[model samples]
Target: MSQANEKTDWLHALLLYGLGFLLFWEWLRPLSIISDTGQSEIFILFTAFLFLLSYFQLPFWLSFPVKGIAMVYALHEMFFPGSFFDFLWLNYFLSDFSQNVGFLFDGRFDSLSNVFRTFLFFILLWLISYLMQYWLIQTRRIFLFLLVTIVYISVIDTFTTYEADQAIIRIVIIGFILLGLLQILRIQEQEGVSFSKGRFPVYWLMPLVVVIAFSSLFGYIAPKAEPQWPDPVPFLKKTTGDDGEGKNGNGISKIGYGEDDSQLGGPFVMDDTSVFTAQIKDRGYWRVETKDVYTGKGWESSVRDRVMFEGSTETLFEDDVEVEAFDMKMNMTGNEEFDFIVHPGQVTSIETGKDVQLLENPLTGKVFTQNLGESVVLDNYNLEYESPTFSEKMLREASTEYPERLADTYLQLPETLPERVGALAEEITSEEDNPYDKARAIENYFVGNGFVYETTDVAVPGENDDYVDQFLFETQLGYCDNFSSSMTVLLRSLGIPARWVKGFTEGEFVAAAGDYREYEVTNNNAHSWVEAYFPEVGWVPFEPTRGFSNQADFVSDYSDDEASNTETSDPAQAEEEQAQQQEQLPQEEAASGSSSAPFEWSMWYTVVLIVIFLLLCYVVLKNYKKWLKRLIISKYKKRDDDKALSEAYFRLLWLLDLHGIKRGANQTLREYAVQVDQKLRTKDMKELTRRYEENYYRGKTNNDGWDEMKKLWENLIKKMQS
Candidate 1:
């Protein structure tokens, strides 16, 4: 083999490895969007390492241990908190492995721990990396893998929030190049032509490269046609009866307040259409209704008993709560009308132009408007309500003793609810001694934890999955519904009376009226929150969503010492302090003139570290052959014998080939020696070839001045280097 052939092989291997990595990347990219599989970058690095080992043709005995160490490191980094050499991680891995084996036998896949699941994922990636290498190198066929990669990207792009526009372009470029190279290799093999004979196939590859580049650029700049077909996802869902309605009647719902709460989960699209506007001095959550019974999937009312009322109001809260009377007017804006009135706080009285009757569901606190035995949608209405502010001191000292009816209605959890949910709730609230603190702890858990506030790309629970359990442990990314529902269920699991309430957020501020502020509420403001019932303080609203702040006010009475100790205990006070800190941050930065200097330096520091790592890698890869040559020369120089002479002679031939000496496929050893002697202007190659032939082909063990032959081999290597 000549240097040209060796260079060609190295180039082909690098290209194949690159294409294979890109294909694997496509498979891993969707894990972050469609599921809870984080740490995709680590998986990508592991796959790249596997490909590197294969490219070097490392023996399994050496490579397997290296891969095992890498896998252990990845597991430790992702799931454990300890030193790399700590034995505790090993113990935990073994425990998870043993338990998962039992789960596998019982076919309880969902019960598997995340550590075991990640282990399985690593094993799967190992298998895939091996398969990719085999397809790229041994068989010189990757069409099936490429095709599957395209299909995978397409399906994920259509079904999830991931945009695959750039991915498609990348696949096209890589797929074409892979196919072209594989075809070149195939033609070379069939015709018995060495890559050295053609010198890298520039004539074959340049045209292929040109065609691919031109086509990709043209396709990118060309005007694309609109989608020819309607989206089939909805049609397919309807056909398969998966139209956001699960087996237990709980699945994805739309963004606005709807009459049905039977199904809830999955992603929803935002609707910015205006719903109504209110003229009021204060902003608060507009309550529509509450659901008491949680059916493992969603909320529903256990009873439908109705009580009729006139213009006056029904008692919504206890009399001990402090209240302030306020009057507001609501004007409907959207075409879609509803019979229920959206009111803030407890309604004291309602006045409308049309004669109407009000029927309220005591079980659900949903008030309906009726006129002449028929439900009516009021275009405009005046509401006089008393907004109650609960005393935090009273709530903290509130009794756990609940009325039987309230406990039975609010503390309802399905039998199928996972035990982990209750355990997690207890874990979150274990430090808090009072119900108020416990509720605040659970509510704030979502804000500081890894929970994400996302509207699209949310997962719908499977048939056997509980909605709250899925949100808490699996996909911690969702909108208000997920957070509120999970908190409510967690509260119920802890023997607290809580219900899920859905309504509108205080909408965007419009303008200031004469004595009040005018606000415009849109369907985009449709929200849900948790309401835990305190024995004496009534149902208090809690905002557990990641980005949303609770609007209800709480009055706390604390001594100076208590205030100092628990300054951040009040949610509203904490929010106010956070706001004050943010307001002061700019001033503080200006005064010090160095507040942002550390952050700026840290960014540059990270960039420099990354650049250094890449530069080191480049240096190692570029000079590795020279290092290997030095290592070989040092090893064989110490042994001066016939066997060492023969081995050193063959290694010299490889080195000479790397230095561009020609070796024809049909050439004998003497012929190759003549070519090397002509190139290096030395007769040392001929002498070494004669000695090698004598020792290897004739099986002669005579040393025959092996020292002289070693000198000749070293001389030939030195001349070739010059």
Candidate 2:
């Protein structure tokens, strides 16, 4: 009986420890997403170690030293570089600890080092582990902890990017199972009943498991209602006065075109919501606006000038330039409405099926639709434009004599621009003679260099740091904005007339519509590039972004010579062929980008093993009680007569409880026996209870009427089973 009680206690401790570890793990999982915490695995292992010590019910004298050693080892693995017993690390640790202790006394929490902060976190876990044990064992209650865990996950899910969908599901299941088990234990304690050979009452557990499983499945499969209230994120931002416009705030903005270009550098999450679609014969960049001034951090227009035009015929380029006039239709997706028209190339005319006036900003090249002196949103519009194709001969032969107004306007730069930027520009364009070659040299410099195209991890410039200088000299990592802005600044530093351009790329092709191809443009296609003004060439587009090809046409001098050898004489056919060739380049570049790095098979193997181990644990935990009960029953049946009689009486009590014939706490042995006899319609329980009392209280364990006692026990067990 004592051994069975000890085993039951061990099993209970193990269950408590497992549940505690799971709850603690939920807390650590979001740290990496919401903060800069690293080496989370070490923290998880340390938590498991602490819970294991609690499970063993170790003495404080022994457990304290073991836990201390484990914490020191974990800290060493996470932060230290030398051997485990290195004196240098110990000395550094002691010095840092002293400094942090002073900081604590001074209330200077922000000045704490990583090592000292980690030590405090370890102590926190230690206290939490002790509290969990106390709640599980002494009070047999964990509702407060479960409630806090739910709140923690929900708050992070609301404020941060941590998706708590699976976490919420796991918590609900674990919490229900834990509450049910704790309730059973509480009842057992109240009734002064030990668990039957360390096995839970399977009948009680089965209903709990079935209900939880069915409810979870139904909840997952049921259709959810759409949110009736407006999203709280924008409301929260508005209350905080963070419009996310310009340099007023440092928050991440949604991916789309905005009027403000004063702040450009920061991480942005991808928004795949469709903006609009275009139907055109040829693919081209959709120009929105241009910024002439580089303020060392971001782009902004120096002039807020507007020019009203009557008709759609607005000539933006000189007559000497070569351009082809084409027509395209723009259809808004209705997901969002805009007052401005997104056009390809210079606009000549617009047909909106309404008598609306057009507002054009000559300085910024942005056009807006107005009705009755108020901005109007259009659902569909037809536009005519001239797509310019520049010749390499004209670009190479164009003189450096710049127009006074153009140079002053497009070559604007901040006074705080770094000096190293000009030097690097010179070094890169030294081999080139003409402006076109010089621009190409700077544009192609980012291709094979150490620069990387990343969106999320890009760094925002510090107060003392120039944005272009940081990307070029320090980080060398960013997305389209970084590459395009750097190229514009680099050109300005070299006395070249350049401006920053923002718009959407030629979007993914959907299907062919009569004579044109339809393209769907989403927010993900929002892009930026560089436009440098050349003599007699106007402002030509150049794509400096890695993994992207320039969509503008650039004809080589030998193109006419090669055209005679090809069968396709139509200019549109040639243009389509060139577009197809340019499209394939980006795919090839992206594929070759990771070809040099070898795959890590060990990582895959480790992930597979972890998944398998978790599944096995789930299976064993679900059905282990039944297996344990059967083993214990078989062992009891094979015992000697003196021991068998005592074991049989205990089994009888377990069977009565399992069959809902439980004895009340106030009932004595005789009263409980009479009640059980009445329930089973037999007099055997009275005889069995008398024999058990004789052996249990009177110290008479001689097994002298063992055959009759066995017969009575068998009869009662058979009646209960029936």
Q: Which candidate is the best by TM-score?
A: 1
Worst 10-residue lDDT window for candidate 1 reads 597-606
TM-score of 1: 0.54
lDDT of candidates 1 onward, in order: 0.77, 0.77
* Candidate 1 lDDT tens digits, 37-79: 4466778777877777677666677678877877877787666
The TM-scores, one per candidate, come to 0.54, 0.52
Q: Which stretch of 10 consecutive residues in model 2 shows the poorest summed lDDT?
A: 563-572
List candidate 2 stretches off by more than 4 Å. 1-156, 161-214, 217-248, 310-322, 563-722
lDDT score for residue 545 of model 2:
80
152: Cα error in model 2, Å: 9.4
Cα lDDT tens digits, model 2, 505-624, are: 988777665667778888878999998887877788878886677777666543667423432222333444455555544443344452433332332354345435544654575445
lDDT of 2: 0.77
